[model samples]
Target: MYINPEQLSSYAAKFINLLIDYSPKLISAFLVLFVGLYAIKFINRIIRKIMEKRNLDPTLTKFLADILLWALRILLFVTFISNLGIETSSFVAILGAMGLAVGLSLQGSLSNFAGGMLIIVFKPFKVGDTIEAQGVIATVLEIQIFVTKMLTGNNQTVFVPNGALSNGTIINYSMQGERRADLTFSVSYDSDIKKAKDILLEVLNKNPKVLQKPAPEVFVKNLSASSVDFAVRPWAKNANYGAVFSETLEDCKTALDQAGISVQPFTLQK
Candidate 1:
């Protein structure tokens, strides 16, 4: 095609006019973008410091900070486009529609994420805590955005969804720093109740793992056709709960056996 010098010069002049008209806004947009980014960084740093001082979980801190950073960036991007004389209402509408579609498709995941946020903020349980939730008793290994990794007593790794975990009943055994071990021992109905009780108490007292402040107690819990049941309650540090429970059970039986008090099997009620 043959080019016209006059038309070519006119096109160039229009391009220059457009650039000149938008230059100030463009500069302002770039300036805002850089300043906004720095401000976001400063805000995140301050938030992290506050969360750390409040002893919030490290995982939650990082996750929240990243989320805030991206949200601010998106807002800044919309402002930049608007500054360049681009209509932004339609752009924002499109983003909202896209977000709604994605949110609908990820309802379950969103529920779990919300539940995780609640857990992290309220702290119903923490890592290393032994919690019983969803009928599974386990020690918390990690608390992720959607699931909590737990190590069960049988050495199994279980991933419990945060949605169910947060909504259900959670028994945190380590929260109180101490746990009471409820142990029941059965003896032949012929055994002396007082003597048996003394033996059980002695067993608990001798165990170094048992806490002394709460004071262990042993009392007759039930009387059946063949045996008498003793409820032995012992308080110990959460870390020693299992040890105290097992050791005291063994020691109580040994003491009773030495006293000629025959230990009997628990009789089932019809």
Candidate 2:
């Protein structure tokens, strides 16, 4: 269809006026979005400074504050989009569905994260402590977000899931300022008990690492099938534990053997 020039010019002028009418909404939407964004950023900076002043762990403070900041920014985004008349129910529904699926898939990981929080709160064992947990002996290296790192006595690095550690038995050797030096040695049933006890006392007395305050105890604890067991308990500083334990056991055996007491032999294997 052919149109007259006057009619076309009138439509063009009306279209320009309509553009002018909507321009304010567009600009306001943009201005609100940017202002909200900057405001959120400024609040996040404030939270970080507060956490720093409180001497919180930098990693944890950053992580928690970032999560809060993002939540605020997302709320602003929903408000901004709504100002432009965009419905947010469907968007929220989509997020909920995705969150449920992700939570199901990462249940164990989420539990570990929760355990990490508990660890930070309770602090049963800090980094550099020697501990025995679940029969695994190690020195704590780092307390991370989801797992704890350790250096084993054998010089191997190990990572334990935080949840497992939190629920399992933990023996922090470093917690006790002093440790009992435990040693067990078997001798033939015919050996002299009094002499053995005397020798053990002598061994402990000579060792400067041993603590004299506890008063070392020596006993013939058991009469095994092949030999008699003596449980030697001596107290000492934790720092000298391994050394004292090793030396005392070796010397006890050697001195007993020199006194003509032979350690009984037993073969359980055919």
Candidate 3:
């Protein structure tokens, strides 16, 4: 179809008028968006500083800051759009619907996220703590948003989802600064129980790592067909637990051997 010059001119004027009418709203929207973003950043900075001052958990602090920043930015964008003569109720509805869909699809991730928050809040365990959870005994390396990392005694790294970690039983070994080391030794029935107990006490007392406050204990715990068992319990600083345990066992055996204490050999059952 061929257009007349007059019609073209009229269309151009109307388009120009429409642009002029929307220009102020568009500029205002852009200006507001820019200013709002800057304000959001500033507020987030303040929030981070507050969190730091409160000594909040680092993982949860960063996660919360990111969430707050995104939420505010989304709200600012909706306001900016509304300024451009867009209806915001429908926008909010659409956002809610989209959030529901995303939530359903990311259910496990959301559970993990919630679990992370719980861990941060409740503080069942923290980084560097020796913990046993989910059938794994390890030191907590990091507590992340979705997973927890751990280092086992054998120097193996493990990653467990936060959901299971939060929901399961957790044994925090390091919470107590000192731990009791329980050692058992078997001696032939011919050996004097009193002599064995005294010797074990001597070995425990000589160890500098063992604590004196609780005092060491040595008692005949069990009597078997082959030998009598003595239970030796000593308290030591958690940091020196392994060393104290191994050294005490070795020293006890050496001292007993030197004293001619007879130890029965273990025999396997057929």
Candidate 4:
């Protein structure tokens, strides 16, 4: 049972050589990992600043940057792990399967996200904008990936999905510098159309909020079965719209009353 001491010593030296050979590879892998992570953070910070400078929507900007940075960092870490002699293909495959399952589950959410991306890029509307969409009228509060939040005149919050919002007609009332108000209060056909028009014109003229560039126009709109329909088109600033609408309606009633115009009540069928 006598063994060669030299052979035993040679085997021990071989073991030391192997360990020495693997040490640099291990260090290199760690170096790459740290460097990749730092790079991701640096790049993400730069992107965030650029987005802020460009006046991008804060919520969208942060969400996208975070997702991108984390994605890149995970990919780099996977590569680094592979460099360290670890199997990573199966991990990636599992992640891909989970992503597919998640995608299927979030079909509606994906549609909203896609729509929100389009909105952020195209800038159809933003917070504080008064827009009409899906038959709902409100001021935009925040535009989220899945939904656009709005505050109604009654101070109620309304959440409209981006998918439905993007698909439907969005009437941006604030886009135009001036809005032409349409106020209709029918009078008896026996009432003189000329007199009504004159009275409306007078009221519009006295109003300072009404735009003078495009003069107020009052004309016979339609001949109804029981009343003479008169259309009054008065241009006013977008901000003055609500108040002007109310005041003009009152002014119109006053003018009609002073001019001896008679309003017919709705008749009920017995």
Q: Ten-residue segment with the worst summed lDDT in candidate 1?
A: 261-270
Best by lDDT: 3
TM-score of 2: 0.68
TM for every model, in the order presented, reads: 0.76, 0.68, 0.81, 0.76
Report lDDT (Cα) of residue 29, candidate 1: 86
Which stretches of candidate 1 lie above 4 Å from their native place?
A: 1-46, 54-60, 76-87, 267-270
Model 2 residue runs over 4 Å out of place are: 1-93, 258-260, 265-270
lDDT of each: 0.88, 0.81, 0.89, 0.84
Shift in Å, residue 63, candidate 3:
4.5
Candidate 1, residues 1-270: lDDT per residue as tens digits? 999999999999999999999899999988888898898889889988998999878778876877887888898899888887789999999989999999999999999999989998999998899999999999999888899999999999999999999999999999999999887888987889898898888988889999998988888888877789888899999989888978887898789989999988662221
User: Order of all candidates by lDDT, from best down to worst?
Assistant: 3, 1, 4, 2
By summed lDDT, the worst window of 10 consecutive residues in model 4 runs over: 261-270
For TM-score, the strongest prediction is 3
What is the C-alpha lDDT profile of model 2 across 95-149, one tens digit per residue? 7999899999999998888887787778788777899886689998887778988
Query: Judged by lDDT against the true structure, how good is candidate 3?
Result: 0.89
Candidate 3 per-residue C-alpha lDDT over 95-135 given as tens digits, one digit per residue, 9 for 90 to 100 = 89999999999999999988988998899988889998999
Candidate order by TM-score, decreasing, is 3, 1, 4, 2
